[model samples]
Target: MSSKTGLLVITNPKQIGLVLSSVQQKVSKILYIQLLNALSDSASGVHTKIFSSIPKYSKEINGIYTQAARHCKHLDVRVLLSGMKHNLTKIKTQNPIDIVIFDKVFSQTEIDSFLSGKISTLTNNYKILTLNNTSEQNSEELVPEVSSEEEKRTFKHGVIGGTFDRLHIAHKLLLSELALRTDSKVTIGITDENMIQSKVLHELIQDLSTRIENVRNFISDICPDLQYDIVPISDPFGPSIVDPTMDMLIVSRETLRGGHKVNEVRDSKNLPKLYIHSVELIDEPERDPAEEVKISSSTMRMRLLGTLLKPVEINKNIPSKPYVIGLTGGIASGKSGVSHWLQELGGLIIDADKIAHGIYKCGKPCYDLLIQKFGEDIVGKDGEIDRKKLGAIVFKDRNELEKLNNTVWPEMLTEILKIVRNATEDVVVVDAAILLQAEWQHYCHEVWTTLVPKEEAVKRLVERNQLSEEQALLRIQAQPTNSSYAAAANVVFCTLWHKEYTRQQVQRAWNLLRERMCEDVLANCKNC
Candidate 1:
């Protein structure tokens, strides 16, 4: 196998026996089974049980994503199916398909017909590998039975709609069913703009172009002969309301009402009513127990917690050993819990809030400046700045809050930098709630931001801090939104669920960080 680029052809998905039980032993070893089994089982379910029990990657197989990596020391080659989430940067063609491993044996003519000009150009130099061996039996004793659930059906022109973010099993089941049922054309109206605003973690949804590209790619994979019309629609009625040519509307139980609504609108226009086919949304057992049993994009976004989201960046000026991590999040978003974990993992914690507390003491420079800006009355009779009194003066007025931040933030930054310069530990954690607002992310190697949804934050603030729900909500709203933090952060952490789940994410993130650091160190020493 050439790690740089080479195709692996497994002629029949059934040849793999639909097995992935050895998953814990070696992840890479199960790729064949996971990939092939998914293709094998995707055919039978009339949108119901087909993909319900299959590995997550089966749903993940929208395109020819392959790596012919064997005996490659530097590469781990693990495509662990974690919540439909992968590096978003790769959508920019950073990881173009070097190898395409397919289960079907194609005649040379059929293969030539399906290969796009771009794909052919990409692997034009490589040989078309057919790794078929006809030695095995035709008996059921030797090979497991393929699922008859992938039974095919057909419609002339069908339509479906969804956000399709981080496409998972449920999406694949619906799309595969549509592909199976449609004989001539498939029209997909992927939600975008205001239509997707109601989705959980909608900010993290893949862009319109990315979503459309993936849907098109998947349909092409399932049925290359059909003409596909994919569009970004802001409303529920894309072309279905007016398109008289449409024959059917593919929908899940949740979306069955929308299909009826489509027919209602069609009736008003005197257009022929398109038939509505409903499939049960796949109930995936692999998802987080804290999330809905029905697999969803929200769950996928949750799984990205405590993971390095952006690529590793090396500043030529900064030394690599004591990798500084800037951690921040909104109020009651479990930011402190994550910081404590990092401290336990050997990171020297630079508590920015504590620094602010120290600098707000009576004699501190920030204390003097804050009194000059707001009033001497902002300080307590005990000769220190009373946070409640100061908060009363600042929180009510935007200008006063700006003044307060302007006075304290620079002082906090100075103390944080001082500690960073003198730290002796191999890791430094800058725990700043205002890390982004203060522009302090520039000091660290990676910005790890935490989040708990606004509702959770409100509940925590109301119960723990004795604030009213309205007050808690206002406090949360005052801070940067989760999407804003995600945009700037290199890593994201969330403690919305139980602490054990949070631990798993943090542990994974730390392990990966150590590996990355080791690689950086090795690369630097290679020249020596």
Candidate 2:
């Protein structure tokens, strides 16, 4: 079904949870919830308090994810909430809402007045679905549940902390609760630096700026008038432990302990203890049994498998029959391991090292050039260049290595292209170690890179090659950094964990590449 942008209206704020069933069935790209009675006063009112009212309703709908299970996993969780009394025109101006849904409490006349430009800015051209009937009277049946004193209360300032990666529904619910209770300011401490070091698939997490921007955007969408001071935090307790002005702390079940710790630190500082409010963990019933019970950024990052992470630029000069994936990484960074996975997944592995080795043999194109450049003394006793002896000569000098690369790389590239152009496999992996360094990505469809932490790469080299720490360090520093590989890559893999994780990353890349190739075929057919 085509995506529709929808707006849900609830006359009684207490019944917000009652419409999760309806929401689950909605294919809307985004669903905005607007509360009619958020402002108690029509003429004289503090309008910002409506944000707090949303969290009360959010609690009612918290079970929706459990109900939808994995079906609503991709449901846009940046749910926008606003006070409907004054913001109807403002919302319509911001979004092109396709449908308006009302709870059973709204009268037909009330909806009519809303559509006829009395309060709602929605045009009559828009489809309107109402749960209310004209024949039904609300004399006694439609009384909403009375909100508790806590629900009715609002605070001066509220603080919350999280990684906020991918910004899933759980993150949204927590942020909504923070905006709900806090009146003036919402201080968000986004976990980064040393804090993100422990997360699984942490490399895939959006950067600190992106997370902060998304959080700020979500809050601005739901409660635009309120102030949000976003900061990158390295420690467990950031501004919450230090900001004496904060009066409330919003936390999930996971961070409930951290919230109390914030209070404990505040007590020591002689600052007012924040009122700690903890929300339940969101249930993700379809997730792997091994993962946590809640919807998480790490799970979302894992789900990025078999999906396009970056755009691929089609090189028209190159033939598309065997789609080439140029794979590269630093020394001991598991490029070979990833290549093995791709080969098993049906990609024709064109090993650049093998091609270069072939060129170094007798009668091959680079055999004479190797002797001419590095001297005939480098030749082995068996009429071929001795690789170990040549390595000793070139390894001591960067300029000598450059001279050798300049002599051999062109011949190797020509041989690789010849193999690729004639291959029958639907996908081709040009496993080149210096793909980017030699400026070889120009011929391929897209590049896949592998990387590991610099220190981790050194550790792997020491353990696997039985090299000393100093020797491993020298070899690692000789190659390109992770940043360089990532910059040149369309997809990235890390084998720092078990081989199973490496297989998953490679499998995801293979599946997505197949899908992309199929689409390319269809496009070519249409063009014909």
RMSD of each: 8.7, 5.5
Total clashing pairs for each candidate = 8, 1
Task: Give lDDT: candidate 2, residue 103.
Answer: 66
Report the alpha-carbon TM-score of model 1 versus the true structure: 0.76
What lDDT tens digits, residue by residue, belong to model 2 across residues 100-152? 77666545565565655423445455777766432223312332556667755
Q: Against the hidden reference, what TM-scores do the models get?
A: 0.76, 0.78
State the weakest 10-residue window (summed lDDT) of model 2: 43-52
For model 1, the stretches where C-alpha displacement exceeds 4 angstroms are: 2-153, 280-285, 292-295
lDDT accuracy of residue 177 in candidate 1: 60
After best superposition, candidate 1 residue 94: deviation in angstroms?
17
Candidate 1, residue 85: Cα displacement in angstroms equals 31
- Cα shift from native, residue 21, model 1 (Å): 8.1
